[model samples]
Target: MSRVSRRRFLEDSLIAAAIAATWAPSRAESEGSLGRKVGPNERINIAVLGVHGRGLDHVKSFAKMKDVAVVAIVDPDSNCFEKAVKAVEELGKPTPKTVQDLRRILDDKDIDAVSIATPNHWHALAAIWAMQAGKDVYVEKPVSHNVLEGRRMVEAARKYKRICQTGTQIRSAVGSREAIKFIHEGGIGTVYLARGLCYKRRDSIGKLPDGPVPQGVDYDIWLGPAPKRPFNPNRFHYNWHWNWDYGNGDIGNQGIHQMDVARWALKKNKLPNSVISLGGRFGYEDDGQTPNTQLAFMDYGDAQLIFEVRGLPTPDLLGVKIGNIIYGSEGYVAFTSYSTAVVFDSKGQKVKEFDGGGDHYRNFIDAMRSRKESDLTADIEEGHLSSALCHIANISYRLGSPQPFNPRTKAFGDDKEAYETIGRFEKHLAENGINLNEATYRLGPKLVLDPEKESFVGSAEANALLTREYRKPFVVPDKV
Candidate 1:
């Protein structure tokens, strides 16, 4: 037998054996067009992809749901299987079958949905495949690695008529909902600017030499869609967030939650008119490719969206270390956490507070049964827009040139907020022990965008970053 066919045969045999041992065929079969509709009372079988880091939370959350069954745990690393399987069993639930490859379970008729918690790169492909195979999907935040990939995900969801939910859990928070409602209702009168802060400190991954792939890991599968290269320890597991090929850095990481909220407050259902980014990987030098300290300014005509990512130790901005601050004519709203926010008048007086949480997973399952995209608090389109913001900002930064630190710049051009923001950015770096005179920072060019097409205008270099060159067989298709 051919090598590829032999591998597939073994994988198939393993899946059949595991399913035979753990899963029963007596469950109600999925019905309706493309298996889009699920019976309200029937259990919805799901597979949890990428069981390391955030994915473990997915397993725990879904296993606790009586209406959902985590029938399979798929990851390229066999090392994660034990903990995931135990998570289900400890909840008095049946043990979920384990697989190293997600494709092995995509054709399984009994599996009705997939909860994708894989790295940012694997998200689009895994989700598209599942939807094509007639499965609903709950994909995590910054849903795509780049602009084109995110748009394709939206297309696949629309064409397949699948219930694809984005894992921006804050959208399901009652506190956030009320806060946004208040802002839209003029509680924050004439909202003009929104700042998303990712002041969360990230330590250096430290320089590590490339080494042999770990045992029990399907390295080729793990690299899916990303270019093939030597297996470096720093680029494996959670640390992949620091690499450009596999991750979109911290902005697309923790900052995306706040990014979504900021955009939602502005009521923008499209991309911004222009975007520029500045910053660099400051402090200790490491193998990390993306910036550790960065700032992005996005022009949205009457209003603007500014994002800050700081990996070094720093004080919180306006009582927000890793959240959002919405500025307006009357007052401002501060999102303190994923499930909480506080409102303050223009005079700095506390006016109100909002605190509550809801089940994002439950929302996804509810939409699965209803088969309504509108039912999703964070639909695929919402994910695409927010994730595209991160990607565009990065594109500008990637195409930037290094310049000496200076408070004054024509980049803002008479905008006080943009000027003040850059001034603060300089001061923040100086305070962190960076010598402004000796150190240079990347100052990205202002790249204008045709929001309708979601493409950069005139600049071929900037436009090229909207998508990536996919590796063979693992490609996110042009058509989707």
Candidate 2:
């Protein structure tokens, strides 16, 4: 067997053992009594997981809802509990019980749902566990560490008959809804391509030596699905977004919002037929593992999606710094923010604009009450599809080799848009003082995928990347 295949075999064996030893569906799980229906007048009790950053938003959003209660705050970092508690108490709501580990609250009959804003690595396992425990879920974007875990989350949601929502809150926005409607109505005639941009500047997380775990931090639980390693400030808290072990870089981080919008504009629900990615961590070197400036091209036969992630400073495209520009034959739509978009004709003339917002939390609560997955604006299936796009692109990039920059190569075969995008990417790097003559970028192979199977075609190496090696007791089961 090839080295990659052999390694995958060992990993799969270990994962199977872990799942068999650690996981089993109980009678309560089978009957789905871990969750209780919330009456119209009754409150929906919730636990906000990973209350360090985004989880705090969940606490504040839910604490203000008349029919929702922030019953508990969960995080591996106990230090974050104070701020979360303060936010709830300041809102005139009762102080929420704080816990460091999510597993501690899984069996709580009072907690009806879990808003998972944990790190990317923990998203799938957390959501699956909550679903098994009969709790509904509102997991953040790029909902899994890898592609297979996402499908597992979907299966668990289906089996448990849970009201699971993706945290792509843009789907709940009034403006986004109207804009999508306009596209579907042919406001942008014959849409063929979508360009998602993530031009937000990211500073380097400077090198830091291995250090003692912070006080009050349940380090082991924090490392849950991720491999155990000595603590480093660069790989903790917010900085973990750049690490491959715990995060999916900016593409899966801030870029996922735009990526989802791009895919939504195309109205494609399945994975792309093929994908290619090329870029590197340019400008400055640090402990960061993922690329700072990257370009991914996903081919969907008749339509195409191009996503750009520029971590260094750069100019906006069509007045958007971190948004989507969906190109149609007659006109195009440009998203300015999560809840706002502008439609322009072929001549760049302003046609229409959509500007408004809606409450994603409220939408989730409504679906939970109705006990219908169809009521959700961004259901688990939608989340899995979009999150899978990011994973496949990353998988291609990971299997790539360093190649010198070349603008004239027909790597994209006759796709002019792809070539033009590469030109722009080169210029963007040059403007940021990247010397192309000396530095080389990782040019990933164009990987063909069987969308129906959700696996790569004839590439065991790529298929192995669809999932990851699991840590015991925290494994995302093969059978949900």
**Per-prediction TM-score to the true structure, in the order listed:** 0.94, 0.94
Instruction: Summing lDDT over every window of 10 consecutive residues in candidate 2, give the lowest-scoring window.
Output: 16-25
Q: Which pairs in model 1 have colliding backbones?
A: none
Compared with the true structure, the alpha-carbon lDDT of candidate 2 equals 0.90
**lDDT string, candidate 2, 181-269, tens digits:** 99989998998999999999999888999999987787878898889999999999989999999999899999888889999999999
lDDT of 1: 0.90
lDDT of 1 by residue, 345-372 (tens): 9999999999999999999988888888
Error of 1 at 7 (Å): 11
Score residue 229 of candidate 2 by CA lDDT. Answer: 95
What is the overall TM-score of model 1 with all chains considered together?
0.94
- Which runs in model 2 stand beyond 4 Å of their true positions? 1-25, 406-408
**Each prediction's whole-model lDDT (CA):** 0.90, 0.90
Q: Which ranges in model 1 have alpha carbons more than 4 Å from their true place? A: 1-33
Q: List the residue pairs that clash in candidate 2.
A: none
RMSD of 1: 4.7
